[model samples]
Target: MDFKYVTQEERERLYNEVWDEPLKIVAQRYNMSDNGLRKHCKRLWIPLPSVGYWAKIKAGKKVFKPDLPKVRGELKRYVHSYAIKYRSDIDKYSDVELQSMKGLSLLTDGTIRYVNEICSNIEVKNQLRNPHNLIKQHKDELMYRKRRDKELQQASFNTDYYNITKSKYRENKPMIPIYVSEVNLNRAYRIINALLFAIEEMEGFANVMLDSGNDKGYFVIMKTTFYFIMMEEGKNKSKNNAEEHVPILVLSLSAGDEYYKCTNYSFKFKDKVDEPLEKQIGIIILEMLQTANKILIEEMLRDREYEREIKKKERQRRLEQMRKGELEEIKILQQAASDWNKAEEIRKFTNQMELKIGEIEDEEKRHKLSRWVLWAKDKADWIDPLIEKEDKLLGESEYIFEEIIETQ
Candidate 1:
């Protein structure tokens, strides 16, 4: 049968008809090669059911294969059913109550603990008061000092600092606490809690191995630090009615041989907070942090693998150069032996000719022989040139041969 003459449709029809038959039978009946038949079946999208599917089909039971549309409809129905059944429960839930949910509780508690610990720590407290709080409290004073310094074009480096301190003392600043409404605080907490739970869920699939024992996991610590900053802001704002609350988080992570540093996570609320709002801000921050960490880790791994490949290639190239040098050395030694052999052969030939000339007698014959002897002598001179040429070849060979020899 001329398989090439067959159209695609004909091939597909032939494939389907013999698809259920034994391979040998199909090949014979269709007048087609077994491989051709198989290829045709694959192209046609014919359901050549797996053994498991066939067994189930034979048993007269419907298989539980979920189609995309059916699965999507089922999901929609499930979500709708839940909405109908628990609409009131969901709507009535306070932010605090939502944050207390099993999944959210773990994250909220972790963040709260981290914040409290940081605030209570003497060193951290000092840093906060001297740097962070100072920056916030004396923002206007610092700005004024900066402007004055610029205007004066002063050479003194400490002029700006002196002006800021002077301005701060002149103001007689009252300690004003941060203010946050109860509603916003609850919201912020809920948002953060939700974010933490989402991150934990993702972590299950992320293949991140947390440090064992007392060793702090970089990501965990980073999250803790970020949460601490948010919590501190929340607490400070809770006391004063004048300042509006805002959710903000910052995190840093450092690791590896090169001490690669990264902003592990950060988030801030763009909207003004009329009340304490933590939940949404917290959740957004947590999600961003996890995403950044994943990207950083993947990038680091890819770079490390590329570096390893480069080192491997360098090692292979060195080995190849070493092998090449050894081969060239062997060739040079062989060439030298061959040249010496040729020189010895020429020397023996010259000696034999000399011996033959000595045995010849007769005046005319001797005279003619002398002329031949002079010609032979001229030829004998050629040996020196040949030997010189051989020496030159050896010298050139040695000059070209290079092998890396390690010095002690």
Candidate 2:
């Protein structure tokens, strides 16, 4: 496949040409995938237009370009090359190569079947749980403030066990306070236990622990942790079992840098409150497990990518050093070749003048020609040794790289 080495400035120009165009279309022009172009742009610290930028321009609204940040490392030549994948290539691929390109088997049929069986066995116990007066008061205050101030009016409810107060966090974000009822706490534990078993079955082990906050739980995997908080809806099924109640479970994930973002899910108890809570909890836990697995894989891929970049830079540095070592020899040979060509031309001209000396009739002209011939002969004689030295040096050029390698 052919490739073109693009300079940083040239890359920037190409990016600008497609700044307002869709990345997929631009990638097609460059014979690469959209994702490949995006990654290249990211690696080069090139700023790309954000979503809605072109839309804003079409709407006649003012739009601004994002400034590219100055990177602190030496820019390497980007070899732009790619080929669109075709079905024929897959057919032509060797079994080993095709196998290497395939994704890992994340879940087994047995694991899926087991998870489903466990979920089927979950029995939800009916309990008449009421919210504390403080919880009610907080909700009321939140509603009032939300209506009056046009700002988020979340009420604070911190206690010995559960908390619903605005807590300090890494990334500043608005969050709704969870309301965990006495009944839901019991249900939450059952859900947690089931998830632990499922994760253990799938991944061999689980490291889930209750957080210091008392109301939250955390599942740690290597350097990353997934934190979650569950809350109960105050409404309960009537004595006649005519009304249905759904409990809210807030799963707050610990995004690195101490940031926690919550994903909320509500489990409806339909008429199956007597049915074990396994199924409801199983579905949620399965999602969490899938998400956690994805996060872990992404982190691993990122670490490998970083290592590759470091190695690439190191290789470039070594190559640059080798080139610098040979640069002087290369310059000397170039200069020598130039002098040799000039010397040959001068010698030829002097020989032709020698012939002209016999033909000259005027004494003044012959005298001037003789002086010029003497000067040319002297210049050619002086350049002969230098030309020989350059020829020898060119022959020795092959060994220069070997010596550099040995020294390194």
Candidate 3:
């Protein structure tokens, strides 16, 4: 009923794991309860994590991990159970469960350290040369918007241009989501195309989501869906009589909702004084990808917990159904009545066979037919609970009514 790790190597591994994350986490990985794992560690002379160890690490503070003490004296001689079984435990499946638990030891600090590890071989170019398909589509849409705006601006006495412009912005083929001025529209597309290519280079897919009539940037990276948005941040400038915001690209990432522990992160980019946005595009994509990995890990944990709950509920439901099926008396009577009806149908069919057997002229065939009719009548009697007839192949008459057996 229990699994023990008296060996020094096993104890060391578990000790390192507990110190690496926390007792609660290593317990989950080993399919052991928190208290149970703690007790085993104590028995094996393994060191446990100190209080506030994980918290201090999360807060970016220095933390200490004490080395595990030697497992000597009584520990070397005696080995307690590695895992204790509860009342409903089935050890036959322990190997399968442990196999399922394999590779579950997730890195505790990985989520927070995601951005730091994302600085890999990714590049973002400044100029847009042979852009992505989406980039080309948006570029055409941008051109259309610009030309339409110009036509509407120059139409002083034309009411038709005003009417055409009213619905033209909304009905553009593959509507562009960027809200930058004419001066920066092309620049935005180049930056976006560069990021998309950079993401693709790093084994990720980047695309834009058309929500209703607006554009919402999203990408498929690490098998997780992340929503990103790009906006122009700048001071207003007067071009002719109309005022426009100067072009400065700002990018942010978000995914899921509040229920998913929704991740909302912004890249550390503000102005052109440091460098062009294109140069830093690779890091920005990495940051977004890191957050996606975080969300993926969180969702996996939630799903595992949810599956456990579902299994527990399903077991309880089966137990309740079993008890209910045993206690229900009317179902038994209904089953008996149903069997009686079937017996009568069989008898009726046998009667028809007996009457039809006279039409057969062949002697051997007629004899075989008559014997089958008699066997069919015997089967009908066997099926009738009141008659209590024993059948050869189906064994003896065990019950007057077996509703559950019939249903099963």
Residue-pair clashes per candidate: 21, 8, 8
Q: What's the TM-score of each model vs. the native?
A: 0.31, 0.35, 0.47
Please give the lDDT score for candidate 3.
Answer: 0.64
Tell me, by TM-score, which candidate is best.
3
As for model 2, its CA RMSD to the true structure in angstroms is: 26.6
| Model 3 backbone overlap count | 8
TM value for model 3: 0.47
Q: Rate the local accuracy (lDDT) of all candidates.
A: 0.41, 0.51, 0.64
Cα-based lDDT at residue 255, candidate 1: 29
Q: What residue runs in model 3 are displaced by over 4 Å at the alpha carbon?
A: 1-121, 153-170, 182-187, 235-247, 258-268, 272-276, 329-408
Q: What is the clash tally of candidate 1?
A: 21
Backbone clash pairs for candidate 2 read: 122-276, 122-277, 122-278, 123-275, 123-276, 123-277, 124-275, 124-276
True-structure RMSD, every candidate: 23.5, 26.6, 19.5
